[model samples]
Target: MQHLDDATRTELEAAAFRRLLHHLDEHKEVQNIDLMILADFCRNCLSKWLVAAADERGADLDYDAAREYVYGMPYAEWKAKYQQDATPEQTAAFEARQAEKREQKDA
Candidate 1:
């Protein structure tokens, strides 16, 4: 990547991001709690990132718009169609991850 020209690198990055969205779109069964437990991020985090990126670039984007883009539909629609209630195990794992993150931050 360091050897790649900036424009080419950016293009590759964009391609990868698109592929990620497609992958997530395909994996609708993967719940947000699962993602949070494993990676500390979920679709909603991506939406927030999109909004922050837009703000940084002076592009007009709000949370709802970013969420729609990320979810490939309105978030409420996605939640109704696919989101699931977190199992007790998932909830425990997510809580543990949160505690670890806080410990690291404080350390």
Candidate 2:
């Protein structure tokens, strides 16, 4: 990063981000709950981060629109096509992980 020019670094970062989005899109079978449980982030997290980034740059970005950008479709369409119901075990694990995170944050 230090060796690269600012423009080149920015371009590379943007390309990497796009590649990550493409990877997530290609792996649609990977559930959000599993991502949250395992990695503490998911597509919705990406959407929220996009919204925040836009706001920081003085751009307007609502939740659904940001979601559409991340999903490569309308949120509802993406959900219908790729989302699946989480199993009870997945739900429990996710809840437990979230609780642990909250506890760590509060400490």
Q: What is the C-alpha lDDT of each candidate?
A: 0.93, 0.94
How would you encode candidate 1's per-residue C-alpha lDDT over 1-107 as one tens digit per residue? 99999999999999998898999999999998888888889999999999999999999999999999889999999999999888889888999999999999999
CA lDDT of 60 in candidate 1?
A: 97
Scored by TM-score, the top model is: 1
Alpha carbon deviation, residue 63, candidate 1 (Å): 0.9
Error of 1 at 101 (Å): 1.1
lDDT of 1 at 77: 98
Checking candidate 2 for backbone clashes, the offending pairs are none
Deviation (Å) of 73 in candidate 2? 0.7
All candidates: TM-score: 0.95, 0.93
